[model samples]
Target: MNTQIQRNYEAAKQIYANLGIDTEKAIVKLKDIKISMHCWQGDDVRGFLNKDQDLTGGISVTGNYPGAARTPEELRQDLEKAYSLIPGKHKLNLHAIYADTDEKIDLDEIEPRHYEKWVQWAKKQGLGLDFNPTCFSHPKSDDGFTLSHPNKEIRDFWIEHCKRARKVGEYFGKETGQPCVTNVWIPDGFKDQPVDRLGPRERLQASLDEVFKEEINPAYNLDAIESKLFGIGSESYVVGSHEFYMGYGLTRNKLICLDAGHFHPTEVVSNKLSALSLFSEGMLLHVSRPVRWDSDHVVTMDDETLAIARELVVHNLISKTHIGLDFFDASINRVAAWVIGTRNMLKALLRAMLEPTESLKEAELRGDYTTRLALMEELKSYPFGAVWDYYCESSNVPVREDWLKEVKDYETNVLLKRD
Candidate 1:
């Protein structure tokens, strides 16, 4: 243990103990909460199969960062480097397009065998895996319509892809001993206003129904539906709005995936977690940062990020909430982006766990808003960082900004060496 880190943690632990917050227990609880890292960040969302395809469906990776993982082996190597820096074991979220098979196959023809390599790697790393159907950035989605396409043929095509994607998720869960969340998010709407808004939504509803018609074991694979307010092409009307998924998920017994960047600037995913927890058995979260719209900026330890983590801990929704990172910033070191975002998320959870929620709730219960407000405000300046540094040191990972050195070295020796 780092002597300085241990000394500071001791002082901080006493302070938290006074507030009836067990710092050790907080660390223990945080150890169990794992954030699934998005694989798209490694290759800027340009999956191995469709290297030539330009991303569509409002998805864009802006920077021309060199050394983007060009193959499954490279991506996994990058992920392994990233995981080494970030403390604790975590899951890897994969898209259908990242299939690691020598056999050339389209998204609709995807199967569990295609992702066998990913599962094998996950098993070796002791990490779980999550899956998503690649509904965007493909020829089938060139018109920015999938699942809700007017052509029944296209809808069926996507539906079959999603169905297969679920099987892949099931394979992952069964293999990893952790449940897999197969989230469905499609860009199916018009750029301009259409008179037939109801028609597209109805079609989307039917498409999702068809996709999820086969009931997979919930223990192995849990289905989730993610919605967006609007996107580049679908600025006027997005077929799968928040309400659409909320209704469909509740009635159909599917998980609702509330993304941080998928809503209006005024709306926050943290506020929705508590409400959604009431009706659903579990919910999936795509934690991201939005500059103005759904920009998918790399997550920082911002107010919203902290709030989102706080909701999970405070509302006791940690067990029911499936947390996953959803940002991709190619301008910076891709591996560093994963480390920074994931560390921030864990730090937020640590801070949230350190909070004296029971005492605050008691104050609120008695209408003693002054103590509640004061305590919350004061905790913002607490020695949470000391505890975090100690946690990092204890976890055998770098403390504070020390992890940056490893990333910088990796960039020089490995990432930059790639063509």
Candidate 2:
């Protein structure tokens, strides 16, 4: 082994020791550390890799919005860059272009490049490619796609979009070593009342069925069919958290992707285990922080949120999930947003390994697992802000000057600290 790699092993071993994880199980589980490419350099994955930060050898290619290949050479160059960034022992997840909604929600303007060149280039680098097929065009879908729209024409348009995306995905799967990913986060739900009670659910099911029947089965592969949720929109446009419950229960796709930040400040309410319970099996988790009700805070997990988020992971409520680094803080410096986001996720995972005082079985038998485990939530008598502060203080992260002081003021003013 390289001397540098050996040093990293030693550092990780010490961390596991502090966390009370058995070294044997620690080594095995530590291998699961994964992060998204967006947090480092968007499409420019190679630019961020170095000996200083251990890139988990995993990458999730952002859809071609900001990082669209301006020319064929650019695409090839990006492919080469991504391949070079794959950590020696790990594989990169090259995602496909989803429809761009930041602008006017245009889909036709953003057509996917032919799979031919990508396959050829990825094959040369021994790279893997994943596809994200999205449909937000079509006038009928102006209100929503897949689920809410009642029109057949809109449904057909979405199906066609999936067909094109899946065709390219199938080619990539055949040529590249990685399976293709079909990711969709439809903005579909009713604001008022009355078009069709079951329109959203039926349309979503139909669209997925069409894709599975036509594209996935023919390819003789079952990669992941991830259903995403929410993009900033009118209140009329936003769907509640239950939408995920409906999507997961209705769809047959075994693996589910959960965007932790999409739940927004409500995630402050749902907690991590409650979020994981929506889907029994999880394939990917988009990790980021939300504040003041914004979806793209892109800030790292604060001390309080991390405490709650990790307890869920350690208990086996969620497993086999990749981190998406799902943040888009346009206000902050771009690189800074990503850097903070990635570091925060790493810290949250490490903090989560903090061993429990009681076994999971013991907690369950005593009925203290889900809601009770959220120490912040348990102190209802105290002011909400004060209870939140107490949880942050107890999380035990070393560096938290900005957050700690602000919450400390609230705790001192609001709650009477126990002697």
Local accuracy by lDDT, each model: 0.92, 0.45
- Clashing residue pairs in candidate 1, if any? none
**Per-residue lDDT over 1-419 for candidate 2, one digit per residue giving the tens place of the 0 to 100 score:** 33543454456556546535444453244345545434123323322112122211111223322333333354344433432322222223443332212333233233334445555655776555555554333354555545335677766766666666666666666666555544554556544544554546655666666655663652323334443333533233343234544465335644455555555454442254455555544555555555544344564567544654465555554344545555544343333344455546554554454344345446668897683466334322222222122222333321234433433443344222311
Model 1: residue 378 alpha-carbon error in angstroms: 0.9
Q: Report residue 172 deviation for candidate 1 (angstroms).
A: 0.5
- Which regions of candidate 2 fall more than 4 Å away from where they truly are? 1-28, 38-113, 116-128, 137-148, 174-176, 189-196, 215-234, 237-241, 244-251, 268-283, 303-312, 317-319, 332-336, 354-419
Off-target runs (Cα >4 Å) in candidate 1 are none
Give me candidate 1's TM-score against the actual structure.
0.99
Measured on C-alpha atoms, candidate 1 has an lDDT of: 0.92
TM-score, candidate 2, is 0.59
